[model samples]
Target: MDVEEENIESDASHNSNELGDTQRLHITKYPSQFRALANKFAHEKNLKDRRKLLEMYGNHLISFKRSILLNRKRWQQRYLRRQSFLRSVFMQQLLELETTFLELIPILNLNGMPSKNDLRINHSSDVCTPITRFYKDLLKLESDDWLAKFHMQKSTFDWLCGQLKENGQFLGKNSLMGKEPPYERQVALGLYAFATGIKYLEIARIFKITLRTTICRIMKSVAESIIKTFGDQYLYMPTSEEELDEIGEAFYSASKMPPVAIGVLGVCEVPAKQQVNSNSIESENSTIILQVLVDNNMIFRKVKLDTNQPSLFLEETNEITNLSPKLIKNQPVSRFIVTPDTYYPLRKSLMHKYHDPVEPHEYDFNEAVDHLFIFRDRALQRLFARWRILKCNGDIDLRTMEKVVLACCVLHNVIERNEKTFNEQWSKGPHSDNTKYTMSSRFKPVLNELHGKPHSWKADGASETRKLLGQAIYSTEM
Candidate 1:
């Protein structure tokens, strides 16, 4: 025992000497120092009783907030899918046909010609368009697809078709040997033309009509039917006191025009098939002007088709003979404002935009008048947008332009009265970029060619009438 104690003391002395007496190899010699650390934990540990619902909801909200890019990508995917479906629908419909003549979407190509196909169909005598079969089952289409193609509801088309039979006097050949196309087919042909504005030949291909002239005849008949059936009710010039009062009231409601202010007038050019005289493809120089008057409701009161130059349609009519005096003379019972952009002939009892108005009242008056013109511009935009045939997409023939436009106007009024709604996406389409060219360059020439203001536009009297109307508009706004 004495020897062991002496050895331990010698070892400690040796270690202390070697490690400078401060360092020790057994650093964890005190195991009780770490007892509290073993008992306490830093992380959450109620594993059996804790709820994850709150965290799940927070994660969902974060995902929803950050999903805008994902939504856009999905929207694009859906649009592409719809387009692909439409293409397949038309292509498969044509491919199912027994002949090659109508196997392609002619309107998809330029000038109503189909593209080259490696698969050639042998020409045969049995080839005929399934127009009857196609027309008979149009109601089977889903409502969205129906509006996309026809620009109208199926019920509306049905009503028009029925009315046409009763009163439209649609010109058609009657024979014991062959059956005429049904009224539904005729209306379909015309409505399709108005909806698409594709070439007549392309229209023919779509309907599988062998002769392009048949398509024209069918379209003309439908136009005539529409004009004949509904023209008197919707397109008449208002000369009667009751009609004038209703129109004036509509204008007041629409643009805050004075009680006397009725019928906004404007001149617009629509795409016309190049005339035989036109050698230029520059569409700006080739368009034909359409002169029109509309009430506050954007309904056409007068449509003077092919008003190539200044229009005399109003003056030449017997109904408006007394209207001119009331408009230009001191009678405040009736008057109209010309479109702001036009150098309209001075004789039409028209009031031009403000030239130079004096004080604060005149400035306010000019603003009200500007709002009036904005309303008119919007009216015209809505009018033309409803009928794409007038927009030059359909390449309307010069001979049939009036009939087509008039028919469209009649249909527009009918639709407006019926309160039909359509998907706005249907109007998005490939319009010819060149069709956007304007003929506003010719307005100065219009004034030049007219020589001088007519007797109705006596300068002093016109000024008083303008001021009276301006004051009325300004007071209304105040």
Candidate 2:
């Protein structure tokens, strides 16, 4: 505005001059000659540095604002995601809760009815008449009839019942709607269960038990009692030298193998309850292997559940390791137990039949070994025969099965020790499979019966003791 006003004033002055001195004013024109002027501090060093600093500060401010905005956006997105996830979780939890309530509603007893019916407390069945009469006249039954039916001689049964009675278990407390069973009745019930493999209900029907659960309790209690009372005495591997020697001599007398052989090894797999396991698609269960060490008399010396792992007898408990090495026919020999070829890593303490015997002496050794395995197998078969309950496919829990099996083994030993006669006809009866076992009365194995399959296993140097044993047997035969 000032410069324009000045130019107007100058123009007016020049107009006046044109009127007066028009020629001079018209020819005169002037421009300033000083160097072009700009901001005096702009090119100063300090000002230049300050300008650069301001630019950096502006850039920093811009970045900070951008970062703040980005952070807000990030948090907003995270909040949305978290809200979605929580909503889904809340919905799922609510669904689960609803499902749980729905599941529980039916089972809830609003009307105050019973949650479960106790079959033991309220049984509808009555005692069968024949069973009542049979038990009443159990003593009047014949010796052979008793043996055939109960798998024990009358005297042996009486002896066992007496022993059980002394234990003073099975109070017959569960016997509802009928007379309480005595100790004898309890023993009879257990023996019947052991012999029949019959269901508790059917056994109840046959035995006249008013409450089948009473029969179950009677059997379970009796088995538990028998195991607790006589398990150690009846089913035990002898560790003492005297006891070992006696057992060894007895086994030697029967098999004519070697005097060092004390026990015969056998394994019987009893059907057990199928266990629900995460590992297997097929119902995860292994048959309860009753790994047994028995003497010549088919008496179980050692009984164990196969949970001890793969090796059958000596490897499990190391029982034979305790055996003081014995001399048979003036040759050094380890007092050992005989096992089948399937059991391996044969050491002095354990022996199996020769694998693929090539020599004549090998055949001879195999013959003698056959007798040992026959007795071992026969003992196991008789165990199955004597107590058919082991064959029952029905669900029997591990603990109960263990008790029942151990109880049967105890009874077997007691019968053997008492010289109880085992009737041949008993093993062929209803509960038993029609498998024929050789006569233990003679302690003899028929050669024609020796059809045992040979194993393809070749013994390594670890089984040197067993190889030496085969050589010694050959030497003894010579």
Candidate 3:
């Protein structure tokens, strides 16, 4: 491609509008610029110049290390002072930081790899030498400052020259496609510290780096990185039967059975009391109903409701009798809307008590957004894999297959938020004549299946009801 075409491709790939500085550095469209920048700052011409430059950068590096060490010490102090609340938070942060930094090492190493022939570094000696030296000094410092041993010797000049050739001549920003720049590294380290919730100084020590760099990176960079890289993916809401099944399974595995779940939103009127001791059941004003399905194996079946759906109560009330008769009667519902709104108590009761979740309401919206986003993402990936497998296997009824394909495509497109990425594939429009052939070819079999088979869920309503009731019961506290 020509420069314009290349630029377009590069722009598409890099797409800085959403990415952070660390990501931009990794793309390295301007290796030459980074090289020049590094060179302009180097101090060493001979060994002395190398030492001076190394000393300058070395101080920063040492300061960074010290800050981390100090921060860690402070954290330990705090933990000792408070064995209860603050300590757990401190420990949790440390673990998160360690995991993030360790994960980044491979990316950094890949980016920092040296060229085979040293073509770029040698060709751009003016800039390359200084940049190379800066790293060499870092390495030297790591190697316990070997220069001290060679100091005051004739070999010092030769040693400095050797270091200059090797140290200052760095692989520019693009040297490795995935690695980050020094500045980006600073920011990432800071983020690592923040995420780990370690004492800032301690995190600096762990990374062998600076508090200022860490602070700046977290405050200005990491959140954006997470957003750009993970964005809507982090906000994925589970929508598929398979995904719901997996969640049910997870809840089942994590908690116990007999879970209760409310899927939709609506209001329901509940009665005050049932027949007891030969007395008539008392009438009561309508209260919010939290329609839940108590089930073992989850199956979605439509249930007719007598009144409005459930509603959330803002304050505690003993008027439990005002709830819908259907709910009070404990009839199993396939999908029930806990009217008004679902709150934490109901959510916890569902998850911890029963275990089924149509959707989670226990956490904040942002938290829910983040979680469901991950859940849906993993589910879609599984769907994609399944689809590919099905396609590879071939020979299924075309109409049935088509429905599955279309559904998969529709769901995947919605959940992945990849409209821009898959624009070409979907641009014809799902319903367009151009897509009709492909759609028909795959969906014909799915339609045939629908015709041949009565809905299994409909026939199995009783068993499904049992399962739904179990889900509902398990979903809440008694």
Best-matching candidate per TM-score: 1
Question: What is each predicted model's overall lDDT from 0 to 1?
Answer: 0.57, 0.61, 0.32
Model 3 misplaced stretches (Cα beyond 4 Å): 1-180, 202-214, 217-219, 253-478
Off by over 4 Å in 1: 1-127, 130-132, 169-181, 199-202, 240-243, 276-286, 312-333, 345-348, 420-422, 430-439, 443-456, 476-478
lDDT score of residue 329 within candidate 2: 53
Worst 10 residues of 2 by lDDT: 29-38
Highest lDDT model number: 2
lDDT against true structure, model 2:
0.61
lDDT of 3 by residue, 327-372 (tens): 3236533322222222222322112121333434322222322332
- 1-478, model 2: which lDDT tens digit per residue? 2353355346445544433353334322211100111122234458776576556545544553454455456556666766766665565466457445433332222224443431223244332232134466777989777866788778777777777777747754335233435677777878888876846545544555544345556778989989877887777767778877787677666665767788877754666655544442223454566778878777888887753343444333366766678775565676777765553445566676778888766676677787777777777776777777877644566777777878888877887788756655556755465653222121121111112533222332325555555666677667
Give candidate 1's total backbone clashes.
Answer: 3
Q: Report the C-alpha lDDT of model 1 over 1-478, residue by residue, as the tens digit.
A: 2343344345444543443323323212222222222222213366432234334434533443344335445556666766755654554455335224443332232234443541223244223333135565576888777787878888888888888888865544320001445566667778888876756566655555554445667777788889998998878777776767676676667556665555667677776544322342122224557766767666777777654664633342334435633442335433554554355543335655666778655676566666666556655565566677777542456657778877887887788778546445544556532233234665553452222433445542655666666666776677
Error of 2 at 243 (Å): 3.8
